[model samples]
Structures are given as structure tokens and as C-alpha cells.
Target: MTKILLHGCCGKMGRVISELSKKYDNLSIVAGIDKFGSDNMGYPVFKSLDECNVEYDVLLDFSRADALENLLTFSLKKQKPIVLCSTGYTEDQLQLIENKSKELPIFRSANMSVGINLISMLLRKVAPVLKDNFDIEIIEEHHNQKVDAPSGTALLLADSIKNSLDTETEYVYGRSGSSKRDKNEIGIHAIRGGSIVGNHDVIFAGDGEVIKFTHNALSREVFAVGALKACQYISKVSENKLYNMEDVIGLDF
Candidate 1:
């Protein structure tokens, strides 16, 4: 069995992962870490990683970015692999993750849905072909409770397109105030409302025609499943490196 140390076990995604893992015989949530501890999760939930005493093969973190330092410290000290599924990390925290990955296996992704990752791949393939003639725009929707303004998946898609282009390009997040759209910029807009699972739209517009690629997440189960898959993949990996969904899905990006 793959013993899992579930971080942020009290949150929505964490609870989803915990319940989903019960359906798989090979996966077991041995322990959980959350600021808000719970008693009915079928496992021990600690307020912090320091209090966790159980043996586990890998750690899956769905906690906020603020908790990243502690999670990384715990993982590195234990020589354990970790799958980080949180978003809204600052540049310094991202760099820290990259630096720490040199010593321990770390899998990190903003969005764990396989469909979103696949969309990123598709953008890479299609962006270069359309960059010169098309104006690109990305629209993302999430629940109001999401702390981040533009969802990480939106940025992921934008990055995929930006990297593919030969010319310099910038991202404009929700334009306003008397500025015309730049030809070499990608526009990203965010919408937050009542309990939206997730929605992303990538639009490529030319003079006469428009092409759009969209993905809608109807439920959180998709991410939970992907996280579990990542946990399984990282648990077997001996290489100390920063991994992503592409690694779990076995795709070259």
C-alpha cells in the first residue's frame, strides 16, 4: 500500500482526496496535517507537520502557499517525496521549491486536473502557429473563496503559449483604464462566484475568425484523482527533482 501523509486534510480538496483514496486498495491516508484538526477523517489529523508521528511513503499537500516552507522542511528532513497541489505562491517560494528539489523529489502543479495539463500541452503546440496573426485571451472562473485572483491554470496556459512564441510577449491581467490591447500581449481575465468547480477559456482571435479552446471542471474529483496519481508516481521515483503533471502523465512538455 502507498501510505500518504495528506496535508490540509480539513480543506475541500484535502477531504476529497481522503475520501477518494478509500476507493483504492493500494492507497491509504496514514496521517493528515491541517490547522483545523478533525476527528472523523478515519486518520489522525494534526495541527502541524511537526506533530505528525506516523510513517508514510509520500506527502500530498493541498494547503495554502504560506504553509509551503514548513511542508518542504518536513519533507526534506524526513527524506520523503512530496506532491504540492497549492497555487498562489510568490516568486521566492517558487525559487525555494526549485532549489530544494535538488535534494528531495518534489512534484508541484497549480492545477492537478489532467485535462488542464493537456490543454497546456495543446497551447504549446498551437500558439506558435497563431501568435503573429491572432490576439490571445484567457478567461478563468473559480469559486469566490479562492484567494488567488487569476487561477494558476490561466497562468499555466498563458506561459505555455508565451514560451512557444519566438517574439517577446507579456501577460495583461484584466485590462482597464483607457488602454488598448497590445498585439504582443496575452489577456487573462478571472471570474469568481458561487462554488464554481473550474472553467477556462483560451481564445485566439484574428481579423475574421476566432478559435477557442475551453475546459470545464464539473467536480473536484478530477483533481483529487490526479493528485493520487501523482502521489503514486512520485512514491516510486528515486530521483530528487522538481516534477509536474507532465511527469505523472508521462508526457513530454
Candidate 2:
């Protein structure tokens, strides 16, 4: 069995993973860490990682970015692999993750849905072919409670397209003043509303035709399933490196 240390056990994603994990015989949440402890959770929930005494093979983190430092510290000290599913990390924190990955296996992804990663792969292949003739735009929608604008998945898609192109391009987040849209600009727009699990649309517009790729997450289970997959992959891998959804899903980004 893959023993899991579930971080942010009280949060939405954490709770979803916890409940869904029960269906899998090979996965078990041995312990949980959350600032707000819950008495109802079948496993023990501690206020901090320092308080956790249970043995777990891997740590699955769905907490906020602010908790990353402590999480990384504990994981490194314990020599446990970690799957980071949090979003909205700053540049410095991201660099820290990369640096620490040299010591222990670390799995990180902006969006854990397998569908989203496949979309990223498709974008990388298609962007290079259409860059010269097509203008691209990305639209993402999430719940209002999400603190970060232009969900990380949006940026991931944009980066996939950006990296695939030979020429330089810029991201324009939600248009405004009368300046016409630039040819090399990739527009990204965000929509916030009630309880949207997640939605993304990538539009490639040419002179005659418009092509769009879309993915809609109806529930949180998609991410929970992906996180479990990552946890399983990281626990077995010996390499100490920063892995992403591409690595877990066996796809190249």
C-alpha cells in the first residue's frame, strides 16, 4: 500500500482526496496536516507537520503557497517524496522547489487533471504549426473563492504555446484600451463565478477558420485521481528530480 501524508486536509481539494482515497485499496492517507484540524477525518489531522508522528511513504500537498516553505523543510528532513498540487507560488518559491528537488523526488503541477496535461501536450504540438498564421487566446474559469487570477492552468497552457514557438510572444491578460490586438500576443481571460470546478478553452484563430480546444472539469475528483497517481509514481521512482503531470501521465510536454 502507498501510505500518504495528506497536507491541507481541511481544504476542499484535501477533503476530496481524502474521501476518494477510500475507494483505492493501494492508497491510504496515514496522516494529515492542516492548520484547522478536523475531528471527523478518519486519519489524524495535525496543526503542523511538526506535530505529525505517523509513518507515511509520500506527502500529498494541496495547501496554499504560504505553507510551502515548512512543507518542503519537513519533507526534506524526512526524506519523503512529495506531490505538490498547490497553485499561486511566486518565482522565488518556485526556484526553491527546483533547488530542493535535487535532494528528494518532488512532483509539482499547476493542474493535476489528466485531461489538462493532455491539452498542454496538444498545445505544444499545435502551437508551433499555427503560430505564423493563427492568433491564440486562452479563457479559463474557476470558482470565486480562488484567490489567484488567471488560474495556474491558464498560465501552463500559455507557457506550453510560448515555449513551442520559435519567435517571441507576449501574454495580454484581458484586453482594454483601443489598441488593436497584436499578432504575436496571446490573450488570456479569466472568469470567476459560483462553484465552477474548472474550465479552459484555447482558441486558435486563422483568417478563415477558428479552432478551439476545451476541457471542463465537472467535479474535483479529476484532480484527486491525478494527485493519487502522482503520489503513486513519486513513491516508486528513485530519481531525485522535480516531476510534473507529464511525467506522471507518461507524456512529453
lDDT of 1 by residue, 147-173 (tens): 998999999899999988899998898
lDDT for each candidate structure? 0.93, 0.94
Cα lDDT tens digits for candidate 2, 74-130 = 999999999999999999999999999999999999999999999999989999999
Error of 2 at 134 (Å): 0.8
Ten contiguous residues with the weakest lDDT in model 2: 244-253
Q: lDDT of model 2 at residue 198?
A: 97
Runs of candidate 1 with Cα error greater than 4 angstroms are none
Clashing pairs in 2: none
Q: Quote model 1's TM-score.
A: 0.97
The candidate scoring highest on lDDT is: 2
Badly placed stretches (over 4 Å) of model 2 are: none
